[model samples]
Target: MTHAETAGAPAGDVATEQASHGKSSLPLLTLGAIGVVYGDIGTSPIYAFREAMAVRPGVAATETEVLGLLSLIVWALALTVAFKYVFFVTRADNNGEGGTLSLMALARKTFDKPPVWITALGVAGAAMFYGDAMITPAISVLSAVEGLELVAPNMSRWVVPITLVIILGVFFVQRFGTGKVGVVFGPITAVWFLVMGSIGLYHIVQNPFVLWALNPYHGIEFLATHANIAFVVMGAVFLAVTGAEALYVDLGHFGRKPIVLAWFGLVFPCLLLNYFGQGAFVLNVGPENVVSPFFEMHPDWALGPFVALATMATIIASQAVISGVFSLTQQAIALNLLPRMIVQHTSQDQRGQIYMPQINTIIMIMVLIMVVSFGSSTAISSAYGIAVSGIMVVTLALLLVVMRRNWKWPLGGVIAFGLLYLVIDGGFFAVNSAKIVQGGWVPVAVALFVSLLMVSWMTGRNRLAEKTRRDEVPLEFLVENLAKKKPTVVPGTAIFLTSDVEGAPTALLHSLKHYKVLHEQNVILTVRTSTSPRVPDDEKVTIDAYNNLFFRVVVTFGFMEEPNIPKALALARKLGWKFDIMSTSFFLSRRSLKLGQKSGPIRFWQDRLFIRLARNASDATEYFHIPTGRVVEIGTQLII
Candidate 1:
């Protein structure tokens, strides 16, 4: 069934059921919500203070600089978090979901303008996020583990091993799934926040002056007095906003209210206190103590407890990113921006809980390499801010488009907010760009590889599908033959794969040409994968019963998803279509593109490489779950 067919289906229909329930859950939905959604922002304290301090050139950890940086952090939280995300972007959610892609969906729906630029920018942002995701685990865990050296200097050697073990254990637990471990996430994260706030209060009592940093003028004065230092300070301030994107991404899971409450009520206060605490620690103990201000706040006897808490927090942070990777990949699959891969749902009730073996393994390899390559938190920090800042810039750009198209905000208001955001985010991007030569190349390299693969698969799929459409059998010819010749009847339904919206598909033409007959019921199915993850199952399969003879069902998946045609056919059975797997004849057109002619940015070598790769890609039979013997492949030539 096509989307057009399912358009009017009621809420009670199987495909539309999920869409109807989109608004049902109002409370914080799961235990993982706190840890998954808030962990990244919570862990920002580990490196944010250190990076901010590094920004001041030779300036001692004076009360003034500490206050200045703290003021900037407060304002960043207000503008980027409070005003932009909470008040503005949160309302742009597509059916109560948020992300770059979700925002893109809203933009495309509201504006008919060419969205290629929007999508391109979104992809770049998503690609850069991979870098952030990889380094986040490394830095968060490494920074916490390095606290061992603070308690006993000789324990420095144990940092890498301890961090690696924690990281490996965190990822390994993903297979057991979030359902079990998720129960402890919220309480553990809540405790982590309490610990962060308590430590900050301890230092704040010693130096009440740190509270003055809450003022905006101090930040302005610090920047005015030290312009060069201010420019560098962005590299550090970028860390504070590292997980800002999550606020938008996870909006769909817990809804805007719970997330905002989590942030403004719990997360924000704790983060501010911790940052202030770190400032106090620096002012009282000096810069050398900056390495582990977090642990230093604890009593000598409580160092062990602090380390354990920090370790748990770091693991939770990494778990959040691992799950994020799955979500992003799923989005990519649905959007058709990536090749289909195996996607297994971890839990029946939790639609968001998914596990992709390919993505998991790939991330595991990249993360392990990151740990080995940049052994220390400080070293890994160099590669970190660039990706985060770059992505923020992209998000800002998208937000401008959303404000204009969705909210219909006045041009003046849009420009005012957009320019202000651009200045702040763009400055940070420039500061981070300076690190391109200083280890930032790692993410750039990874983004380049992933982007290439994404672009290749997308273009290749488009070209092949277009070629298949151009060479397909005409529907008029089928109609003509049906009237003139006796219609030979075949048993059951014959499902023919098609890439075109009009006329008889090539598979149908080939079937009729070879067998000289059409099945009693013909299903001209076209699987349309969108550019977002998880098409509302309520609109999953659309069926058009044309005179009870021609049936067309279009099944949609996200770019990071695999299509199961047999499963879809089985779903059709529930809708009153009698489809027998053994009796159903599945026809697939296998297009063979000749090496002679091809267009677009794809070179001949790359085309050849893509064809080779696509051929070996999970077989159509396996991917679609069709009976091997019943499925027939028809080869068609393409001069691409």
Candidate 2:
């Protein structure tokens, strides 16, 4: 089905003009929001400087080398952040929502069964994002908290404790919701840029020649002078664009215009200045000073304040990534890429402030593991760039499909952007590939596991759905012969759970064959999980009368949400659905799979494992909150 039809948007308005005038202030709000959401990219200044300095192992931190490194930093931001993301990728948002999955959804709608290459690339991108999510908080927070050591040499030992405390505080406050705190996030992030710019400005003023690094020639010259060193520099340059993906992923939270404005108007200038400022500081103070060039940019009196500001900025940066992980999980669920988990909305009005206990716990544990394994920001940085860069390559490939199918951009334009982005992204990927032997495998390993789980869940679900469809009985025949003629007179409502939206529900069919009659009030329910994270509660459940004998109720959930059948039924009652929870019988159809030749090679093992695991699992009645005593289960065997 088309996005508009599925989403219930008006038909003619699907490709209407952008909502510009009515939402003018939205752009400004978006800019500030982008600053907060995109802070991870903005704050790379903390570690990017040190990593770049380490590229040339034996060379002294000379003015020329510093200037050359600064040049590369500026261009990296310009090419990757400005040219690629802000100018190009932002324009490819699917109904203003960005990210690989959204783009893929748009492609599927526009092209209808897009090429396998496109789908594969998109999935790879999504798989890699999981790896990026696991490591971002670790690197971002650790780098920020490590600044404390600049104030007191002995305080270096306190970095981990302080970082843990700050992280705990951040996650603890999630229940209060981000709406209240999100209002200030933009302004705080804005100030962060200002502080970063101001410090960079101070250093640049002391060493005015640093401005010469703006020339691309300096970067090329640096590479020519030290070819071997330049190869290693890719790893460092990769750090400069670490958070670039967030810009596109968060396009929905804020519009494209504001992000564009912020990137060009404020963020771009501040980042370039600070990077050059770091270079200037290093040039004057030398190699030893490179360890803490950012801190040393300020006076002795301001060191404490500098550390405080860095801490806050880092926390905000990490918070954005953690929240993003939640958002990604929600999207994955909506697209049927993962199983439904409990997704609690934290706010009454804001749908974005959602809590997923399963996802939250998993991320927290993975992040802690990353911190313990890597031990410092520098080591984590090695793993960080590789995952993000690989994902970008995947995103670019998908974007080409979007341009052709959705935007109808010329083949030439699509090809041009595709080739250019691939080159830049592919080169970075190759550079990061070198680090795989040096602790970079961590994120790749994480991505592989996530990909396996995602593939397994999707494959298993499809197999089960097919089995159920084949075994299902026709509703009209059952209602006429078995249910209508019988005088069994079953009491109360019977809620039969079925995976399909149409046809006779399997549980109801089974009930008729065994018990010979349907309940007085029967509800055939199908729960649909949407691709978006949150759906309006009022629109959560859809009800229709099926020949006065069966009520077809489909409960929809955002990927980031859980399905509480009991609570949904309660809400249904408020909407005039008549069913007593105490008296209603919840019937679920359980499928048992026998290994056979019908299933695909990739899914044979996965389907077998899921069948065994699902059989011993708690019945849907318990999982969905149906009263235990009123629940019934019917099993069916299928050859996969």
Candidate 3:
């Protein structure tokens, strides 16, 4: 679970950026929100309604079954996106950050001793998101390109190659960043939504009675009577709200007011109009001839341009999913749930416009595999909803924990909210689970593999920390011993970094044992990552004197704050230390980890994984933004 930044806590870069974004102009942010936040759900009409009706082929869909599916889709949009995300989940932000991990951070803080199971839920949710990330680009692009069949039936043979080319192009441009093309996103997405509404309205007017599906009775009646068929159909219907969780994850970028306004004013109405329009078309004309109601709505003259526009829209949707995965990876690194990857800040002005090459490449590779394997959107669609449902079910379960423990709502209120959301989320999950033997196994296996790594990393870190803490000697004891046997004092300042604030740093002790010398002014620096988002500059550092040559410094940062040791040292002038970067040496420990024969809590294989993870983690000099020329690394071997 993620934690918030606290006063005097160690922090990183995301908090300050989120703070600035939280204060952006409402109308401008609202425009940007439509492109990024609504991309996933906006593209749903492309395959959602078509998939639902096509789930049970051979048997023609009766008008009642069609209305039932329509009712199900419409209500799912309202409850999942409009109510669950924009209304409830968005309010649980930790200083303008929201996600399964972010909410997991908030939910765990209510009690002194956090429930261990809560952390598992957060990790699993993150894993499921990664699974969704892998499939979204493949399926979205494939569905868009499939529109080619309408323009030219023989051109269908080239769909896979065309989709691959487009996927590669999207991943190839990640290094250049999205700022150059982001301006056009808002305009194009806006146009796409308007067209969706217009096409949907054109058909809806032809079958004016189709509006009856908007009433809850149609959905309730369908579910109450058609239990068996409804149960199976829920899997396909679940796709209608697949990107609902993304709204909360990206909530910090545009702020709540703008996102809410964009949803209520534009995204919501347009989506409903288009969904109802697709249903109207299906009901007016029998469902047998309609492979995709979405493409079928357009006349022959508009087919080519519509396919081109769709390809553009789906690409934007894929871009948003890719960007969201990068953001999640950042949060996971800060929370120490994953190893530090090379994070590239793309835009000079907006930190939110950052990218990760490692993750982007990984996702792109996975997308290509999926496109090659499935060969078409219909086959790929079978693998889609399971991951999304898994994530949603887990998020809602965590929300129940947040509502009761953090919100301080009464038990009755909590139970009502939990049951309501859970039933909706749980029902979807159960139905989707039935697809496991079918193509659904792909995402489930992916999520499980990721969860294995995440859980093992956290477990291994705790074990290593405990073993290291036992070997730590108090700073006061080291100082007193040094006074009795004072070594030759060096001319420059020495800063030793350690997680154990109370003890002498292992690097510092090693430096004295080998070199037999001490710096004129020594500082034991303990950099902390706090539970909040941003820490005040004044509260960033605390200095305490041990003796003439020995000093202890504690630097705390918020989870969203950047952990820049050099910047913090420059600000150390207040504590009577001469801040000269040229004369200072930074001491850091490089632990060479190996698996132990004797095991305690973790499995034998887990220790090996952790050792491998620690071995390959990003260097402290680079991660903390410390100078390389003045840095000293002390090697320590640990088996855990």
Candidate 4:
């Protein structure tokens, strides 16, 4: 099925089911959710518990401390992942799509015209998400591969190289599409979760006292007593819910029902079991003897199989991140924050599966660099908290704006929700404050770099738009002048693609100036990308025909949908638009940008950056899917 067909499907699995199995596919969809949606958080059991325990400063191993830390981790998942994201943040989705950009688009739709701050917040959040994306695969895969150390301590040196090889293979297979392999993702993850729960259960039964951590007071008392250590430990404790955003971000693919069922039915129980089981082991055996508690939990004979299973689970987790960045890149292109890049549909059977070569290459290089630099999962754990914490805080901040302004909640109600998450998020963010020089700087630096790119792109576009608007003549004036001048009428159709449909296109003006003739049927075609995710086919086009043998056609596309001019024009048949591909000539303005002499809303240096970006942007003809044979490129220069 194409993206257009699945656009209305309830879930990714449902889409596949409707294509193959008709309507009887709820169980399959829920299982599918297990594989894709919960991959990241599911794999956390391998490292999160160990990392949190290791972060305690100057504290001896004790049952009270173990229980306390476990309590904190459990509550963090409940409040942050379950309550904050699934409960509230997911509810703020824009037309069934959820993510930083989708939320930003939704916020933009909430007002007559939103302020600049909304755009800034969205960029910040998105940049942070990219930073988090880099860290997730590095930490998740390494953490899983690091299990080799428990089975064969001598093979510790090979862990990094082995992980790099696995990741490299994953990236290599991306172009071939994951449709065949993706079928088993749900089953593997489901089994992984079951194993995690069983192991934790066996250990938890050995010491039921671990259940005491589930009580709120032990966690409160632990924090109250060990304030100093508790602060630092919160950073590691955050690892438990690091990829919680996946739950919300992948909601559109899985839908609310299957994702919710997968979560409440299996993912949550298994995670709690593994966490509490680790806590129990620490309480009974003491932290000193617990050499990688996660792997060591199973029988000695199960070690090899456990490692193999873990490696697969982590790969699935990393796949989620890779797929997410592709979607985010697509959104950025649609929103005009980033220049257009080639987006290829990876799976003809799956609508959401897309691959961008440039983005895939960038992520591959960065992820390898991260793995080589960090060496071990334990070393990279500190950096993980920073990226996840930064994203979470930004998400919560945006959620507050949505509740108060968009939802029109009472002031008291908004503040209550704000304070609820703020206390939890503030502590996690604050812990990473001390680790800036020790790898925490990586993601923060990345977020800043990405945010800089976005801001420069937007700033340049705005100022350049203003500069062009000043020089543009109204379409009415141009039409009246053309009528008086009596330019020769040509036989073929002319389609001038313009950003501003009401103004005369530079290409159209140039065509008239140089060729000295107007086409029999002229169209000022403007493609407008809306803030929504998908627009209905029936309402996709609007046409305005003036009396000067001229036409103004506006094609609307959702931010999630790709623009195809030929396809869109086919729908304009009712408006007397014949759209003969052989006879239609698409005119596009190719502007070579130069830096402005002085600083304006954006800096001179920034303008240079913008020019660089504009020059590298995808060709208008290619991006709009226009036939190359019918495209006429008119060149010009613009200084801004």
Top candidate, metric lDDT: 3
Q: What's the lDDT for residue 77 in model 4?
A: 91
For model 4, the superposed segments whose C-alpha errors exceed 4 Å read 1-24, 57-59, 599-602
Candidate 2 TM-score, C-alpha based: 0.86
In candidate 2, which residue pairs clash?
Answer: 334-530
Q: Rate the local accuracy (lDDT) of all candidates.
A: 0.74, 0.74, 0.83, 0.82
The RMSD of every model to the true structure, in order and in angstroms, is 3.7, 4.4, 2.9, 3.6
lDDT of 3 at 68: 80
- Tens digit of per-residue lDDT, candidate 3, span 556-611: 76665567788987778976777798999999888888777777555888888877
Model 3 TM-score (2 dp): 0.95
The TM-score values for the models, in the order shown, are 0.90, 0.86, 0.95, 0.95
Can you list the residue pairs that collide in candidate 4? none
Better of 3 and 4 by lDDT: 3
* Deviation (Å) of 190 in candidate 2: 2.0
lDDT of 2 at 53: 84
